[model samples]
Target: MSTVPRYIREYVDVNVDFDKDGRMLPKTLIWEDGHRYEIDRIKAIQPAPALKAGGQGDRYTIVIKGHERYLFFEHNADYGDEKIGKWFVERKVAP
Candidate 1:
């Protein structure tokens, strides 16, 4: 049998803050199901590939409730997405 994708793209709502010079920082992420998670800290931000999902943008290595997770932001307006872009996370699928 073919193995299904272990992860699926899940769009989430994020609350962001910007520094005086326009540096973006994510503060919280609301799940698709309306659950909100506060980002405890941001460890790193850099351009990286999005594995298991095609959307690629700046990757944020953040800690939420002491649990580490990767969040992605896809800001390609060429795809006709929102001008402000969107955020997404990979949700693991049970076997």
Candidate 2:
């Protein structure tokens, strides 16, 4: 079996859209590497607002390291709260 690379990441809720079922649709999360991941894992949904309020809450923290940065979207809704609104993406610095 092969191993998977992980990285310590943080996600913040960006936006939410309600469907006919009144259930929340896919939420956008800003990853640590300054990328956005859209996922529909209800359980992974976190209250974005609370996190900004400085209140204690649960967030999906993982370790990822590889060339597949796009794969981060697979673990969407893995952190932050729904109220988080939008998360800031870090800017790249020149070496």
lDDT of each: 0.88, 0.39
Over 6-75, each residue of candidate 1 has an lDDT whose tens digit, in order, gives 8877888999999998978999999978889999999999998688766688999999999999999978
* Model 2 Cα lDDT, one tens digit per residue, 1-95: 76543333243445556899874444555555567655435444343323322323333232233212111222235366553333332223333
Note the clash tally of each candidate.
0, 16
Task: Kindly report which residue stretches of model 1 are placed more than 4 angstroms away from their true locations once superposed.
Answer: 1-5, 79-82
Clashing residue pairs in candidate 1 (N, C-alpha, C atoms within 3 angstroms): none
Error of 1 at 82 (Å): 5.7
Each candidate's TM vs. the true structure?
0.84, 0.28
Question: What lDDT is reached at residue 49 by model 2?
Answer: 26
Question: What are the root-mean-square deviations of the candidates from the true structure over C-alphas?
Answer: 2.8, 11.0
lDDT value, candidate 2, whole model: 0.39
**Which candidate has the top score in TM-score?**
1
